[model samples]
Target chain A: MTRVRVDLNISLDGFATTADQTPDNPFGQDWGRLTTAYVGTRTFRERVLHDTSGAGTTGVDDEYAQRYFEAVGAEIMGAGMFGLHEHGDDPEWKGWWEDEPPFRVPVFILTHTPRPSIEMKGGTVFHFVEASPEEALARAVAVADGGDVRIGGGPSTVREFLRAGLVDDLHVAITPILLGQGIRLWDDLRGLEAGYDVTTEAAPSGITHITFRRESRG
Target chain B: MTRVRVDLNISLDGFATTADQTPDNPFGQDWGRLTTAYVGTRTFRERVLHDTSGAGTTGVDDEYAQRYFEAVGAEIMGAGMFGLHEHGDDPEWKGWWEDEPPFRVPVFILTHTPRPSIEMKGGTVFHFVEASPEEALARAVAVADGGDVRIGGGPSTVREFLRAGLVDDLHVAITPILLGQGIRLWDDLRGLEAGYDVTTEAAPSGITHITFRRESRG
Candidate 1:
């Protein structure tokens, strides 16, 4: 079965990113710190940063980070995550990721104003579409070709998919920092645990990795 | 060097207790499930329930629950915790605890309508007082006799102390269940980790124990 998964790095207070995000400051001041655990992982350095220096922490955090890219295919992301609001009608904004984006699959960007698909150097293909979470997921799933569909988020997007009951597995790495104000991942996500079996593992890097896997509906 | 500490069992969404809290449903529908991790501990059975059966889990959860009563002399709680709203105008009404309450120290209840102190069985004494978090901490510290002063909460009370930057150490046990809606412990207390050295430990019972030890001000 193709699983729908989401992997996000959040603060201890449940904030995934700060509020004052802009084109230049995509994640605000706390972004680096919030994702310090993942960014310092060997998997992140190799897969995301394309760095094979063999640097970065290798343990519980790395294990979890490595799992982030283990399975299947397509990704569904929010407009804010695509850096659209910042470059506003630039007609040239590819994305925050470098020419060779990390995601080596068909990426669906959910936005109000759809744009032409942008295929980067790598296997990543950004296909902008204005559709509901279910529709987007369906499209992503078809593109995934039986592989898992990843719900990439900036908080609001993830919350929508979760509320729609489309997410199958969710992994949240809670860093020890506290971002006073930002987009909260848990807002409107009441009784979220009722549908999933939740488990937590505390890593040596002071990050608590929480995974929620969907139980059988029956 | 007396420390001010807080120990609370919160849901995955940060709710310490549910919203529809009543005298009959003191902790709301999910109370039992949320606190099962703590209540099932041998320390809770012995100390709170006064059970000497010695029949309870004795692992990480038990170890942390056992520390709930260590090195704390006085306790400060809210009126809701004292059950004043339930049995209003009934002077005979004491707390919901048994004739012998679990707290074996001077217990201060912060309420707008202060009443005469009530001495319960065992070493627990309920003293009603109307004061700010700092003032209440001062009174509790005085009675603590150089011991630690514990901030016993129903969420709002703990938020106040945390906002005042008076807590020396805070321990929050994140239960697997989600209350959906209730009194949130992290509301308005943003940037809370700035003052504390935070750490986390995931227990076998699926509870994540998060601790914040205040960093030296100087």
Candidate 2:
């Protein structure tokens, strides 16, 4: 069975995005610290951003990031992350990653409406699915063959999977940023049962990398 | 006038609580880091939990946490933070704060139905209000006098404030834990206009502390 993983950054006060998420500020104050910590090092940045020259080095955070990427064979994302085109009336919107995206595998996007598949350079293929998380995961698993499926999130899609109990191993890069009010990953769940054990932890470049494996409950 | 500040911690992948929230694992893997970094420090534990000290003096995270508490005169939270309890035939629920919550100020809970105020020792009063976020803030500000009003969250309340654009400063301590499935701080606002500037960045105890100040579009 393919292990499902959903990952993202969170603040101490508990907010994912800042109040107003305009393009000028992608991640408010947290992105820089998170990026530097996760991608700042020579080797890590070069690897993820697809650069020839590696600038970052071997640290705990870098190691965790590397582990996360290495474990991912396929990815599932919410439309919120695919692009900000959801807000505008135009249908010509693509994503923030002009032409080529970061993921180098088959990526499935969860949306209410369906669209044709978008093929980017590299092996990145964007497929829009209007089905629920489980349905998408099922299709993704078929496409994944014998690899782990990573959930690229905008929060809601991840929550759907979590609510449905579909994720396996998870890693979250904790970035120090507070949005005072944009979209928060934790909203209406006060009475739910969830448990996890820390599999790994690292602190580097002012970012903390922690991994958790969901505990199966009878 | 005391400005209102929202403070929190988040994962890089963006989850506030685990997919299923329970007391045993109130916040999934993030809670452990928070306990050790925010509440487990010798100085902080003695002060916030045992009342044997004032506050932690050193470390970036300690300093940031101290500053956040100092800035708040009162806290306004949501029902999600209160956890589950059987109130009436409708499953009446109270908060999970137990007898004496760490907060030593007036705490207002935003809810649709009003309840009698429950006063705790050390000045923490749980007042259930059926007012809007603006109304709750008004009461909080008045109670705070000249102290900053802190919008303690569950997500809905935070979104209320964020949508209103009433928050001034945000202090976030990002934790390195991923629930993979849980409530997120930012699930809505698919097409909202928001912006901010990171004024401070620091890493201590493996957690990053980042501050974002709301910016105007003009």
Q: What would the TM-scores of all predictions be? A: 0.95, 0.53
Query: DockQ (C-alpha) of model 1?
Result: 0.70
lDDT per residue, candidate 1, A86-173, as tens digits? Answer: 8748988999898999999999999999888999987999999999998998898888987888999978999998898888899999
Q: Alpha-carbon error at A78 in model 2, in Å?
A: 1.0
- Residue lDDT tens for model 2, B1-218: 67778877655344555454466875555455444567645446654567565544456666666776685788898866665223422433445555777777888987666677888877788888878888888899888867888887765667678667777776656554444455555555332223655543545455555665765322
Error of 2 at B19 (Å): 19
Total residue pair clashes for candidate 2: 57
Worst 10 residues of 1 chain A by lDDT: A209-218
Give candidate 2 misplaced runs (Cα > 4 Å): A19-30, A42-44, A84-93, A191-193, A199-202, A215-218, B1-218
Per-candidate Cα lDDT values, in order, are: 0.87, 0.64
Interface RMSD, per-candidate values to 1 decimal:
1.5, 8.3
| DockQ score for model 2 | 0.07
